[model samples]
Target: QVYVNGELIGGCDITLEMFERGELQPLVEAAVKVQEGNQQA
Candidate 1:
């Protein structure tokens, strides 16, 4: 299973699909950025 921002993203196949389309990195980066900002606050 996979999740982002507490939302479901699905399992390994779906995750691989996102990675293949080059969406995973930016999604992870944005999630990290939000987490960082939340920590700062």
Candidate 2:
């Protein structure tokens, strides 16, 4: 299973689908940005 920020993203197939659709990177980037913002707060 894949997770981000304690939220379940999905299993391998769903993650692969998102990668194929060019979504995963942006999602990860957004998640990282949010985490960084939280850290700075």
Candidate 2 Cα deviation (angstroms), residue 9? 0.9
Write down the lDDT of every candidate, Cα atoms only. 0.91, 0.93
Give all TM-scores, in the order shown: 0.90, 0.85
- Candidate 2 whole-model C-alpha lDDT, 0 to 1: 0.93
Off by over 4 Å in 1: none
Query: Residue-wise lDDT of candidate 1 within 1-41, one digit each (tens)?
Result: 99987778889999999999998889989899999999999
Q: Total clashing residue pairs per candidate? A: 0, 0
